[model samples]
Target: MIVKHGSTTFLKVIIFLTGIAVLALCVWLPEIAIRDARVHPDTAFFLIPFLLCAYGFCIAFSVALYQAYKLLTYIEKNNAFSELSLKSLKIIKKCAFTVIFLILLGIVSLRVLAKVTGGDDAAGPISLCLMGILATSIITAIVDALQKPLKNILELKPEND
Candidate 1:
């Protein structure tokens, strides 16, 4: 029990640090966008939608991190197999999907902007967006895989109890 709590504590700390890092990134992004807008005034319009998408991604990431923290807490409390933990997992899965959707939306918007601005250097951003989508998809898949077993366990738990 002590070991389990300690492990969950460590995971919670990691989640906290991750949240802080993402918050810092969210703060730093606006400055970067402002700088980019000043440097390439023509692409200033592009920056707005991109920044919006970035902010949406950050929000979804934060939500997923919070859900993860909740899941860890559930584990520490010996409620790892409970409905609360399952709910947290579901929320995390939804957050991952939301992130993937946001990334796809950003990619599409980027492509449209590039065509409008005659900007041919969109490969880097598009590639990054694709990677984000892939990573989020993996997370979503993992959560989905976990969900089925969790559901089965929950269904059988009442009978055992």
Candidate 2:
């Protein structure tokens, strides 16, 4: 009905906006890093590895967003419970896991770098990374929970039809 279409449209808009926001962040983060490197040349060494990890996170996030958008499309098309929808959810879940892994690796590297440099105060950044990991893990768990019921429904669908 009208309500269903409206809800999907709103979700699609939100997804589009999220993609744009991420794109902006992707562009802005490097500029900030380069600027900081220029101001504090010694910190430049740390920036490269951190930036690489950040870019990896961005890529995974973008993939998850795209998959979510596709999932919304599937729902709009009355195929919410279909194989394509399931695949999209699976991809999103994997992307969440990737993000969590990247954040953890980045945190470890940051800790090692801090130690090598006589232990700079890295508690703030580490805390942020922990939060990011927690959020990604929750997303992954939610997607996983959804996947099981979806798979069961898919299995039962054929029998019903």
Candidate 3:
């Protein structure tokens, strides 16, 4: 059975809490492990950029979470066609677009940073991941845009049919 809006609201809160917890862990890890650099200096350096990417992901996730939240609220109130759901969907779309843009920017920045830091090795994974994200986001956004209006129309009741 599909979870209802209220249940979804609870899941959204869990998502938020989990996001916050992961962010906090990232922030705390460096300090907590600073003294263990005997074999993990690289871990610390990587953590900085890891945290950056995590925050970027968190931003995207927040957009999605809010969209879910608004959609759930609309479903619960029997007013799914209202502007709030649309607004939330628009925000989600914009956030997805921004994520794609930021991924491109990150690829460029990573290339520059790699050149400066003399580590061509690190660029490969980042470039691969960013390309994947960009491709997926573009496809997902297009599909969502195409199907959403149809979905909305179908949700309407046929008069005296």
lDDT of each: 0.89, 0.89, 0.64
**lDDT, candidate 3, at 22:** 60
Model 1 lowest lDDT segment of ten: 1-10
Model 1 residue runs over 4 Å out of place are 1-3
Candidate 2, overall lDDT?
0.89
Worst 10 residues of 2 by lDDT: 1-10
TM-score of each: 0.91, 0.91, 0.59
What C-alpha lDDT does candidate 1 achieve relative to the native structure? 0.89
Give the clash count for model 2.
Answer: 0
1-161 per-residue lDDT for model 2 (tens digits): 22388888898899899999989999999899989889878768989888988899899999999999899888888888889989999999989988998999899998987887785888999999999888888888899999999999999999998
By lDDT, the better pick of 2 and 3 is 2
Q: Which stretches of candidate 2 lie over 4 Å from their true place?
A: 1-3
Candidate 3 C-alpha lDDT tens digits along 1-161: 24476676787688678767766775776565565455556444654564466467657756666676666667677766555666666766776776676676566666665676574565576868677677758756774784488457545635424
